[model samples]
Target: MPMTVRSNCTGTLPSVIAGSAYTCSRCAEPHDGPPLGYGTPAPAYWNVEAADQPGSVLGEEQCVIAGSYFFVRARLVIPISDLDAEFDWGVWVSVSEASFERMSALWDKPERVEEPTYFGWLSTALPLYEPTTLNLKTKLHTQPIGDRPLVELEPTDHPLAVEQRTGITSARVQWIAEQILHTNPPMG
Candidate 1:
């Protein structure tokens, strides 16, 4: 069932104002979401644009948490000798330039400067209980994608000389790179 509203001359849902709300005409999905209660309203806060059909979230999905410690583990190239991966070793990832760009568009806000992490990496062939650091240098852009201030480093720089690091592997990186990017477009 389509919700009725005063659309604009363009025939699209016009921008709604304060106190505005939407609901299904037949079953009526009461619009009982959160954030604001009185002063303002919901739609403004619930600006999740639908894609495939309507009311779908995955359309702009980025990260799908897998409930595995691997995904959230502190991303750093801890050397195999230093780690306690007695029965652990896989890979890890969080966010980066490419990933952050897409996420920023949907979130429509700048990420906090103090955001815990900014990179990902792969784990060693073995598991460990504690983490270690790799002297093999890394980098972290002082700004977001469009270039603000980028920092560079050398192999000896390691943690002190690097900005942020991760545990991403060459294979996993290739797979993820393929998924996020598109290769072809149709002619109009």
Candidate 2:
């Protein structure tokens, strides 16, 4: 199939907001609305919360640097039916569009395409690409270690899809983790 860059996606979100209420409907132009901060009108979806965009242009703390692209930094994909119990538990990785493009090229083979996201999905997954690395490292430095960045990855597979398949479609991802662990067991 020809690679068609999706300037659009069905019910897809560009980035994740940390603290803001977002109102979106397929009927609206700006489909995804602005961040309503904490304690505002709740989002419409029962299984979803508002997408939070920090007020600062800065991806982290420094001034907002423009241009390029960066990942919508996430740590984990918690499976949940209700919104309150989901949790992020992994590394936050961001990469420039150029590097992301390169990685996409490397991983786009038919064999690997089924398991993850490729360049095609990168645009939507890591929306705004950054122009510099000074703040990038700073963001990483300030982040806690250990459960820190277990892995930095572009969003490829939809967590929703996985949730649907496992019959583990609830807020307890730890249960899924436990299932995984139990199936494999510790090699003691």
Candidate 3:
């Protein structure tokens, strides 16, 4: 199932006060009016291979996560060394950029950042993971096609990467680039 809102929100789903609420644009249930008792923001927290280097970092992104669907805003890349033919590497977590900025300003205080609050990778044969839903889309070089991100895949690329790019829309990428990210959740 697509993610939903857990907070008991009031007013329109994305009210002027709190900006916009995140959800899986394709599969998420609509919040017609106020008092949103249950909803799911796209997975906001993620640990992924550093986009520029060897180490990993915790990052936030705007993306969708639902049964079978594993899309993220950032172009997630995993090193060939990290892939395994038989393993279910868990899920990556992330948040929106707005949330990241909010938390950054209040970084000095440990209690300031919130969970799922408002708010990369490297290597050759790198597999790029992009969002496939418009409502959950982020401002990236690649644009959205209908509800899915516009990404190109090559048949000769890494088998797993090819799989992620070609398999079911929601098929899980066996090699998760985000797991090696933050050893501990960022700002946790």
lDDT of each: 0.26, 0.27, 0.27
Greater TM-score among 2 and 3 belongs to: 2
Q: Write the per-residue lDDT of candidate 2 for residues 1-188, one digit (tens) a residue.
A: 01111111111322222343323232232312121111101111111211233322323211112333344222323323543333332222455566445444544354332333322111112111233211222112112221221122332244432432333432243333333333433222
Per-candidate total of colliding backbone pairs: 14, 12, 18
lDDT of 3 by residue, 1-188 (tens): 12222221112123111322323233363322221122122233322322233332323323332322233333322222322222211122233445434434554554442323131111112223343322321222222221111122233355544543444211132112122211212121
Q: Locate the minimum summed-lDDT window of 10 residues in model 1.
A: 34-43
* Worst lDDT 10-window in candidate 3: 117-126
Error of 2 at 142 (Å): 13
lDDT of 3 at 187: 23
Off by over 4 Å in 1: 1-61, 69-92, 95-107, 111-119, 122-188
Rank order (by TM-score, best first): 2, 3, 1
Model 2: lowest-lDDT 10 consecutive positions: 37-46
TM-score to native of every candidate shown: 0.19, 0.22, 0.20
